[model samples]
Target chain A: MIGFIIERIAFFAAIGGAGYIAFKGFSAIYRNIMLGRKEKLAGNLNTMLLVAFGQKKMFKRPIVAVLHFIFYVAFIVTQIELLEIMIDGAFGTHRFVYHLVEHIAPLRALYVFTVSSIEVLSLMTFFVTIIFFIRRDMLKIPRLSSIDLEGWPNMDAHLILLMEINLILNIFLMNTADMAVSNGAYGLWLSGIFASAFAGWDVEILHILEKVGWWGHLAGVLGFLMYLSISKHLHILLAFPNTYFTRQTPNGYLDNMESVTREVKLMMDPNAAVPESTEDGPVKFGAKDVTDLSWKNLLDAYTCTECGRCTAQCPANLTGKKLSPRTIMMKTRDRLEEVGKNIDANGGIWKDDGKSLIENGYISVEELRACTTCNACVEECPVNISPLNIIMQLRRNLIMEDSNSPAEWNGMFANLENNAAPWQFSQQDRFNWAKEQ
Target chain B: MQVKEMAEYAASGETPEILFWVGCSGSFDQRAQKITRSFVKILNHLNIKFAVLGKEEACTGDPAKRAGNEFVYQMLALQNIEILNGYGVKKIVTTCPHCFNILKNEYPALGGNYEVIHHSTFLQQLINEGKVTMAEGGLFKGKTITYHDSCYLGRANEIYEAPRKVLEQLDAELVEMKSCKTRGLCCGAGGAQMFKEEEHGRIRINEERTQEALNTNATIVAAACPFCNTMITDGVKGKDKQASIKVFDIAELLAAGQGLENIVL
Candidate 1:
């Protein structure tokens, strides 16, 4: 009776949670599609599929990509299992796709293959997660190896560790009970060996243990789902749209951004421009906070799977530059979250504040300028995010607002202003090469 | 306000035989100008009478617009559109990819209505119609060549085959870079990066792209865009391997295609 009541509670809880998650996911999609405001969304959709779903970019790091693909495929196929659980709990049918799987022998085998592969993958992921936590918490890799925060946690590191634990524990518990029930006499290959130590237990006790283990699995899954929707690990919502709406062509084209006359009026007269002086003012260019960023870029932040595909392939990061593409997105997200609270409490982050995007120490102007616009980050991003586009936009603000660009850029801009080219060669010489032989 | 407006103008029912809007690249870049003349000469041979708005052609302001100076782009785009309209020049053509992209894709956003074509596309059409011939071109025996796709021409306009066809007509062995066509790397010259120093990053884009062509072992790198040609040529020279590789504009290649080096002027 207790078991029945608990299962009933879980069934309804899942319905409520799933509804909430589905609503948020749909809202994200609606906002991104309606707000991207670029004409190339259709094109990005096709290419993003190759990157996000086909795991095309993952080929750059075969081991990591393979492990990720295993997790991804398992995560996807497990949806059916989840729906089965939900349906079975609600309708009292234990096997939801049981008829379908039983009919097609190959599919049945494929289903079993996927399930067994997930079991092995779960074991691998469990170990990997443990190592990740240990490395971040204990070993302290080169970047953050030494830092310790007790109450005020490094949220990124803490969130990653927490999600890893949740995933690892959920998979182990769910699969362990599955092995115990279905393994029967012959048993599962890998888990059967592990189950051997418990062979002497009474069959009734085993059955009871199996039920307890299954319930534990469901509970873990529910907690994970709820936590995931509300965390920085929001890739679950982002992956769908990121894949579905990836830029069709490569995203590195910094060509003239199509002019926007609809949202904000373009003042062609330079004298008429209203320049925002601080981070809190109406942002003229470059995002000051989460809401300031293009909705697409914000979506990109949420969609990031933390796979480190970007950081691994980043030439800047690899060459010891302080520019990890991953860090840019993480920092932007973090800063936005930080400033969002301030914005809610007060109308702005600046008291017409002297602290700007640069001065406030949210996004260092130098960090924004560190990007080379090399499509390397774009090429390697699994979600097809364009950090360069964001960087370039920020650079635009830097140049126009403060008249503050690096010396090198200033020289080039000067050449453009004077000679219409970067070489500072005579403007008359422009057509000298084209003169008849 | 959108690229489609330009496309509509091009397909407008009353497109003139040709509207030659000599772009800033063609007007200022010597090598580009020669190619622009060659293209014009070919068009004249095909008996296509085209009008040129020479000194009147101002900067398309693509540089300023891309540099986040939209005010300048709008001003220039509006000015050029007005000049073309004043001439009753219903059609437009240019040798520069940047100019071609702007006139064909961006001008209509400003309410300018006119037809536009890149000279390369015009040359291809003439060739298809047998108005221009590749029968008597000089074939340099020892030179192997590869073509660089300008982003505007390749990615923006999807005009890859026309330039490759022009090169192949010259009897040059067209070597392929690892990244070409839609997947081609940038020359670090587009997006007004040509007018600005590249932000500090791990690699220079032009060098990275030049090396890709270098990897193909082609002696001559052929380019469709003057900016790309200049940047790549500089990249090769910067690496101090200029003797092994040289860059040629597609116009130069076409001049070679027609065995018209003497008539190139």
Candidate 2:
């Protein structure tokens, strides 16, 4: 009795510690997102439902989609089992929910059915995860094997798969060990076969085995929960809000700079009436650092799955230019995280670190210039993340503020300024084709 | 062929059914002019009552805006809008996807709104209305022609079918590239890259896309945008395949199939 009571106390302590750490980790991410400039993102329920919950874009590759769906469904269904484990550990009793509901025959049958289904789903999830591992390592899929995922990203993926396997094995261990001790009293469907192997084993030994399973499974779940905030696995939670908050405009529309629009309208006609400015600081042209990007852009950086789908479809990447869209999102997230740490370390104020997203070790001028703005990457993202927008934001700063466009682009701009076309032909001669024909 | 300028229509107290926006490439490029004339020939045959903006039309500033020069983009956009609004132009059609995209999608935000249509969609409407009758056993009859999807036209605006439907009217076996429609690759000319040298790379973007078009084993590749036409034409030549595999604009193909373009080939 005393051991059971002690075990309950230990479970609570472990869970509380993990829960607090997870809360802190997630709060840090929220602060990092809030460091960005403000832009309105109204709720889009329909987009959220279709793209995020339905995983609509994943269906483009049907085989992998099926594999992923099985893993997702398995994870959700296992939460029911998780709840029963929590209750059993807290109350110093084995299978507490089962015991409470075992009296009503129909409810008992419901319990049996639910546990059996979870076992079958778990067994399937086990295989699917292994296949995903094999696909990543052995299949040599170009996107997965690209230089973008060479070091820590690759390790992150392997660790996630290994953790999933650990969680799954511990479930079977707890169930099968319980069946061995209870002599079929539990009646969990698939684990019963393994339970028979311990028919005449010592009861105390079986009890110890069940205890180990209980503790291992509980620890694994809590640990994974905490780890998600620090890992790319955050996508499992972020995909929902990211889809809802994605910009609602057509994929091609870059919102006009309100400042630039005001200048141009006034220039075109001196009598042009413009709205009064709401000035807090001098208006900067475009994004020079993480702080200049909108909050949603920062959120997009966190939500990236690092799946490399966008990189595979990018024209610049295909033609061997320096740009890879996936790398753009990854760099943004890295820089944002670094900036968040800077704020935290300096008495809650941001201090310039002499680094920006576009120079000397982050996204580069060559990468920014290489983009064709073709919308292929935008079209391919399953989570509705737009790396193209980030690239354009950085390019806007380079051009409008630094005047860093190429000589060829400068020539084009000059021609448009004087001749009203990208070339040097006179506006009066626009009809030359008609006359010459 | 005779055409009336929008200024003439305004002076005569008349309004044409549509304003034909002749983009800079269509006005000045030697090859694109042939495509312009072909579309004009078809419109004249249909008696569509279209008027050109002629010399009064400035560039739509597509390249400038895409290159991150908002100042230049808005400068040209507002200038053109003043003239368009002054004449009360109600409808517009253009052969270039860049112009069509900016005019249709971007202009409204800057106070220059009109009913805008690409020539592919416009030509498709003509076909659907039973006006663009194809001559039996026309010039491109039974030929294998694959259609290239222009980035601004196909993906940006999602008007893939109109160009393909127009190609189907040629009585040709219309094929598709390996990357077609939504997954279509760029012709390496978007985002103002046409005016600048390409970045250092293993190969050019246009050649990569052109190889996909060639893989379909079609005798000809059809394009909807003038920029795509130029890029792919250059791409085909880079392979030294011009003698066997030709690139033509959808407008030129449509006119040639009707025996109306007076095609030299």
Candidate 3:
């Protein structure tokens, strides 16, 4: 009679939790798809997935890569087992995966070992998250510091800490619950620990508490999964695509620009082809707003796990320039989100953000000029996110439209105008170096 | 020859099997022109008649295109394409990978279509077809050499083996830098930086590439692209070890196949 009552409680809780997770997951998936469809992605799926799903970029920094790989594998395996446990407990199935394990003792032993391994990994992840929060928040590593926000938002860091703490608490409680179930008088090994923890308690009360613990575990699992899909954790969606599109070849190779006449003609006639019009006059060349980006670039921004691999690899950043490639992507995202809100409401671009905002500050002209076009950041970016291309496009706008360029650029233009090259030397001297030989 | 004259010269006859677009690098870079002139002589020796684009040739816009200026690039490309089309040119041969890449890849975007081959690739084919043979007494026969892959040729187009094959035909011991072929670093002459000052970086990319070649102690550096040839030569000279090492373009090495009687100043 006690078992029957406990099973009934587990069933309803599972149903409620499952329904909530399904609704949130589907809603987030739909929203991201609709958002992506509205903008073109910069790269192909094969390339994006090569980096994103392949975890290609993260592996460049092996320590973080190993930690992430563990957490990723643990999360997947645990969720699958956790779901099976929920369904079997709710339906009172004598057999699920565990049934096959029963007939094969070795398999059962392997299953137990696997479950324990995932639990240990979860514990490590919990610890890593605490460390991650501290390094990013309290101590402040330059690489991990939030580029999106100015000054300290004490409450934001506190909130992140709280979220991680909540996840850890749930993990602790579920482990305790598993221990309780292993320790029962009926002596199911899985429930024996929990049953033993409450050896002095009445069997009836212990059973009821075990069922409650089961529901709590399910609720926490479902909630975290939903949160991961919706929040900035949206990198979960991006990781797959980033990995697939990563360049398999070397970094020195150039990403060839569209042929010149094709680009010019596209500007002359917007209807000629898609790429041509994208480079058209007065239209920002590299990227200004989120909509200017292809869906793949937006996906690249969204998929940034803030791992700081680009920051670590950037020679500019290493040489003490004010630029951080990771931060550039983050800032672009912050600007996009800020501008996206205004655009959605006003039915126009971010022009209403005030003249000074677009003309000078934020992504200033100096920042654009600072980039060396060496492609170190693009090469190091595991997800194949190209911060260089963005800088190039932005330069196009500053040069083409605003004419607010550095003096040297004008000199370069004059050089190319008079000479076929960008040097002050005479066209007659183009072969001078050859003559000396 | 200008593009128009080259076109006219090429079209006035039943189309020759190849039309060599001797870029300004070849026409004016003295040794490059000499080597190219020798390349012509060598082909003449092999009875492979070819048309050379002389004063009528125009810049390929490689300089402007890579300097982040697309306007001049468009103008030069369109003019070149019109000239090439007028000549009824079908297959193009050139020693400049920058020109080869521009003519082969970038030109198509502007609707210019013609088959393009780098000269090293042509030389390898000629040797493989047994159309040419090295005489016993050549300038570089006994030397150990290392070849610098031009950024545009090797990294841009993946033409790593052809130059090495050409070098091998002359029986020179070809060594490799630790980073060769597609993994090869830039000579700092690409992207029209050769025509302009290199923006400050922690290290000069050409110096970095040259130091690797020097580390090999190969005594000689052979190159395909004139830009690489110039940059590596400058780098070697800059290091003040100019007396220790020599740089030669690949065509010059092939020109060594010529007997004393065939030599020109």
Candidate 4:
């Protein structure tokens, strides 16, 4: 009875502890996002379903899509067993779900089928995770091994795969050990094949192994949950929310600056009444720091999976330019994380770090200048993150705040202001094409 | 071919079916002017009435907006919107993808909404309606032609099929480059690159695109955007393959198909 009481206490304590950490972790991310400028965004159910759930955009590469789908679907389906695990853990019972359904033949069959499928799916997950590892490490699939993921990001990918393997191994050991001790009570098919090997083992040893397996599986899951807050694996939790709030504007449509419009409206109509200058007047034109970016942009930075698909398709990057869309998100996330830590250290007050996102060893003006704004990166991103939008914002600051622009662009601006076009041609001669003919 | 200004249409109390937005390049660039003349010839041949914004037209502010100057962009955008709204322009067509994109997607938010269509889609519609009948064994009947997707007309707007279907009317074997449609490479001229030198890189984007076009073994390349045409032409010349390969706009191809090549500017 004491052992039973201790088991229940341990299970509940761990569960409560993991839940608290998750809450705290997610709240910190929310706080970081709140530090950014506000921009209205509405949730989209259809996009959420098609993009996040259906994994529609991923199908552009069939093989990678299939491999990733196994991980996704298996992750969801395997969670069903967590329900039984919790029940068994709380009650100090073995195979609590099997015992409940054993009385009904149909229910028994359904239970067996569900557990057996999870085992089979686990086997597949184990193999695919290995394959994904090989592709990343051995094959050096260009995007996975790109320079953008040289440090902790690379380790994060490998760590998640190893954790998945550990999780699967524990599930197999626990299920097989249970199958042996219960004498085929659960009727698991895949793990049952290895059940006989454990039949001759001491009954007590089998029970201990089963307990260890159960504890290991639970701890692995909790470990994964806690680690998600700091890993790229957070995409599994955030992709849904990210896709739900994705920008719905057309790819070609850039919202005109309302501040600029106000001035231009008055400039066009000199007789109009002058509006009051905003108390929070424009600060440096565009984004030089992460805080200058929109809250959604910071959300986009946190939600990035670092897949490098956007960079692979970028025209400038393909031609050996410095721009990489994946790095832009990574840098933004790193800076935001730094800001979050700084706030934590300073009693919830922010102090300037003397560092900014642009030209601060995070992103370079040369990289920004290389972008073609072709929307290829925007289209290639499976989660619909627009690195181009961030680039444009930084470019705005470079030109408006620092008066830093290429000579050619400055000339074009001058011509646009004078002749109503990008060239030196007089606006009066615009109809020369028709009159010449 | 007689092209009327919107003012002339208004003076005669006449309204045309479309306002042909001759972008700055179409008016000034020597090479782009040919494309403008070819499109006008087709409209004249079909007896479809169209008017231009003439001198009252200004830049759509696409390059300035892309170059990160919002003030200059909005200054031009407001002025253009005022003129367009004053003319009560309802439908617009342009050969330049940049102009078409800005007008169709960006203008509505600033109160300058109109039925803006790229000439590729416009031509596709005309051909689909059987109004653009091609002569038998047309100029490109036996030639192997590949279509290059302009970024503004393609991923930016998702109008991939219109240009391809228009090329189908040429009765030629339409080949596709390795990178076409959504994956189609840029001609290194987007985002105001046409108005400035390219940022330093190992290879120019247009050169890479030209090599893809050459790999397809297509004698003629069809493009929708004037900027793409210019960049690809320069790329082919850089490789000294200009003698064997020709870059023509869909409008020029259609004009040649209808025996309207004599309409020269």
- lDDT tens string, model 4, B186-248? 998988888878778899999999999999999998999989999999999999998788999
Which one is best on DockQ?
Answer: 2
Residue A76 CA displacement from its true place in model 3, Å: 3.8
Give one digit per residue, the lDDT tens place, for model 3 in A1-437: 78777866857776677668767565544443334323323446766554555666567668777777766766676675676666566666632666666668788777666666655666777777777677777788766664633443334444444665565455445445545544522223333443355556665665556555555666665665555543555565566655554445443333344544566666656676645335434534334544555555555666665567666644345544455666666665555555555755676444466532223345665555555454556656656677765665565545555665556666766765666445454556543332342
Q: Which runs of model 1 end up more than 4 angstroms from their true locations?
A: A1-70, A84-201, A208-216, A226-233, A242-290, A306-328, A344-384, A405-436, B1-16, B41-47, B113-115, B119-138, B155-161, B198-203, B262-265
Q: What is the lDDT of residue A183 in candidate 2?
A: 84
- In candidate 3, clashing pairs total 53
For model 1, residues A4-118, the per-residue Cα lDDT tens digits are: 7787777787768866885664454444333332334554566556766787866765865776676677567666566766666776554455545767778767655655666
Q: Please provide TM-scores, in order, for all candidate models, with all chains considered together.
A: 0.72, 0.98, 0.69, 0.97
DockQ versus reference, model 3: 0.13
Question: DockQ for the candidate 2 complex?
Answer: 0.78
- Give candidate 3's chain B TM-score: 0.90
The TM-score ranking, best first, is: 2, 4, 1, 3
**Recovered fraction of real interface contacts per model:** 0.12, 0.69, 0.10, 0.72
Better of 1 and 2 by DockQ: 2
User: What lDDT score goes with residue B186 in model 2?
Assistant: 96
